[model samples]
Target chain A: MSELGFLFAGYAVVWVALGGYIIAVGRRQSTLRREIARLEREFRTGE
Target chain B: MTTVSPGSTAQPDATAAVADGGAGGGVTTAAAAPLPEPGRTLWLDILGVVAILSVLVALYGAIIWAPTEAVMGHVQRIFYFHMPSAWVALGPAFTIVFICSIVYLVKKDLRYDRIAGASAELGVLFTTITLLTGPLWAKPIWGAYWTWDPRLTTTLVLWFIYVAYLMLRSSITEGHSRARLSAVFGIVGWIDVPIVFMSIRWWRTIHPTLVTGEGMNLDSSMEAVLMLSLAAITLLYVYLLIVRVRQLDMGSRLDRLRQLSHLR
Candidate 1:
């Protein structure tokens, strides 16, 4: 592979890793939100 | 006051008790206080944006501005961001270790524990990025993707240790016990970071030792790009840390609110 090809390949890998992490963060945020909503529902019902 | 169970007595207040009971049948009370209101923190956001721009400039500079090395040729460009990322990963890991130490020493509040957790999570993310990118950079330069060199081996160990730290925090039901034990592990694991650096330096290995002012010499433009990328990644780290901390704080508050609502 040409040098430029290798460089671009490296950049692509970096971006993929970054994108994967951002997605994971988003998933965690959603899960936390769901838990919060569940708690809120239970609290309201108990009261 | 009515005679409360050991678990119920430790709850924050009536509101928190109701929320706790409502949320789960047998959830224990936590010592976490109601989260303070988060003020507008534009500094992190601004820094993140600036860092992104700086990284862009660095990328362009590395590829277009700097002259190619006599030996490594085009592949040498990867070193600019790769080394900075390795440095950036250390920043969060060190922060996690420092905060964990403070939390253990003070023991007055749970904020320190939360900070330590946030930093650990961020550290893991950055470390993973470093590990992944390093190999991509290495494949072309080092002629192989994986190396059992001292630096690489120690880095993998450091990454796993933090991964275990997160696992430890999640496995236990949230409370003082989890925080205390994790705090100990966090500090202990951090000892390996310095060992990793030292081992890489003292022993001969393929891992580039640019920081030692050694064989690998960067041109002026390459140096500028590297410094800029480092600054940008550091800003990005700070931004992520703040965002993660806010999320944790919100989750804690939501728990408390749910408990309080149940009490009412």
Candidate 2:
């Protein structure tokens, strides 16, 4: 690969890694929110 | 007559205990309420804005503003991002993990453990970036993607150490035990850092050494660009650390709630 190609690959690696991590965290946030809501609902129903 | 007793606070003590205890729900939801989510303050807003701005400026400074090297030419540009990512990863991310791990071991506070774990996660991520970018930069320059050079090998060792730290945390089922065991690894694993830094000086290595030492002088513009990239990436690390730590804290709380519900 050319020098420019290497440069682009380096830049792309940083972004794709960062983006994937952010998405994973976001998904975890949503899952936690749902879990909290479920717990609250269960507590409320006295079941 | 008021339904609530005169001595009762807005939320009942037992209910508050349930929230605090994060487990045991025998009294049920009527006896307690979920804590209100905190409002987003101005600081986080400012941080988010700064994160976006720094990243953009860093990219521009790295790509366009920094002059191409006379010898290495266009490929030298990769050094800007590559070095900064490695700087943030080894310096702030791993150091935070090491310190917080010790604190957790001493204080036995889950918060410290959570913070340590979160930092460890980011450490692994950024190290992975460094490892990836290093090879990408090296391939065109060094003519090979992988080598057993001291810096490269030690860095790869450091990466595995933290990766193992994370995997150990994940494999455990109990909380305190997980924290206890991983804290030990976190503390011990960080000893590799100085070794990684000194490898170039300490051993015969193909990896380039001393960005501004011996004969390889850096231009002022290039140094300034490198500094800017470091500052930007460090800020990015702080921002991500805050976010990940908060997420871990909430995750532990959810775990407690699940346990309590299970008991019911």
Write out fnat for all predictions, comma-separated. 0.46, 0.68
For candidate 2, write residues B124-214 as lDDT tens digits. Answer: 8988998998888778876888776666667788898898999999999677888899999888889766766676446654545423222
Q: Tens digits of per-residue lDDT for model 1 on B196-243?
A: 767765675555643232446777767777787787777767777777
- Every candidate's DockQ is 0.39, 0.49
Q: Return the top candidate by lDDT.
A: 2
The Cα RMSD in angstroms, rounded to one decimal, for candidate 1 relative to the true structure is 7.0
- DockQ metric, candidate 1: 0.39
Model 2: CA > 4 A from native: B1-40, B195-217, B261-264
True-structure lDDT of candidate 2: 0.77
